[model samples]
Target: MEQRELGFTKIRLPVVGQGTWQMEEADEAACIDAIRRGIDAGMTHIDTAEMYGAGEVESLVGKAIEGRRDEVFLVSKVLPSNASYAGTLAACERSLERLRTDRLDLYLLHWPGSEPLEETLRAFKDLRAQGKIRHFGVSNFDQAELSRAIALAGPSEIACNQVFYHLLERAIEHRVLPLCERHGIAVVAYSPFGSGRFPAPDSMGGKVLASIAAAHGATPRQVALRFLLRRQPVFVIPKAARAAHALDNAAAGDLRLTSEDLARIDTAFPLGPDRGVLPTL
Candidate 1:
């Protein structure tokens, strides 16, 4: 798979990653196999959070990467509720233990919360210094919040910003994305398939995607993922619990959409004025 730098960092990550959200212990075997399949297919960037399955997903991730840690770029997030300086310190330790790794390639603040951003950033700096985390970033932050975060930590301190971004949810395009581009913060787009809310294959939007997919001999999911991949510095982590689905998403990294195809997709799903409401999850 093609790789891109994470923000201004020297670390390069695959354009597509694997997301572990709502994965439970009940399906641990399947989830592990799917993750390994993604890795085998060159989707080496794996994202998870302590909030996912109450950390069970991290445990599963830990097991999956048991002896192949050197081959993956692991990322995890701290819950906003644990954004306190001391809480953040403790949270990192817990996450590191669950992930069975000494340091995270990238650590993120799950979202904005009641805690002061300064305190969280201070903890991030300390963790980096202590080698508990290599980089730090944020998730679900809009323009104003991201501006404040950058002001608090300086532009280069934040390595990325994970947000809800897709063809249908293009609110970030208006301001958030431009701001990140200015600061050189990589945009990690989660729920690229709308968390199962994507239009069916027979729907209007789906029909457009299908036509494009058919031309490329790809699935609608691959077409959607490739659309996101074409946006440089923007990485998409779509959840796939099945190995087949994981491989399907991985194949998107190789599917190149032509300029005319992009134009058609743009006409079908026009990017409009940013919605004032902040996107979540």
Candidate 2:
């Protein structure tokens, strides 16, 4: 797998990591296997959130990286409701306990909420100082909110901005992505396969994707992930609950799409100019 520096930080992450969103207690074994498979394939950046399965996924992540922690670049998020200075600290501690790690590679604010930005940023700074978290960032933040976050935390403090980005959802390209690039914030793209809602291989958009996939002997999922990885400083974390699927997703990092293929994809899925309201879960 290919690695790139995260923002201005020295930390380098695989372009395609592993995402643990809806992983539950019932699927614990499978989830752990999937994560391990991804790690084994060099997809060391593992992302999870305290909100995921009510922290069950973090526990599963802990189990997956038990003996191989050094090889993983772990990331987790705190919910917006717990964004308060004190709450953030408490939430992080709880997440650490669940993840069975002393420190997190990156910690993110799950979304914008009622908490004052300054308060949340203060907690992040404190955590970094205490070595509880190496870096801090935000998820689902729009251009305006991101600018405000940068203003509050300063450019270097915000390591990355995780958002919903894919061929179908190119809204961030209009402003958010450019803004992050200028400020040196890494872009972590979630739902790269449209949260499993991607068009069929025979559909209008899928036909174009299929053609590109055929040319590279890759799956449509891999083609989509390759497109995102080609965008420097951007990383994609697509969820895969099965080891086979995890390996397949990790392999996408090695697939290279041609400029002609990119042009065709762009034509099939035109980028909308509207930097409309950013979507959130």
TM-score of 1: 0.97
Residue-level lDDT tens digits of model 1 in 19-95: 98887844789889999999999999999999998888899999999999999999999999999999999999999
> What does candidate 2 score on TM?
0.98
Q: Model 1 segments beyond 4 Å from truth?
A: none
The 10-residue segment with the lowest total lDDT in model 1: 272-281
> Candidate 1 lDDT (Cα, whole model)?
0.90
- Lowest lDDT block of 10, candidate 2: 272-281
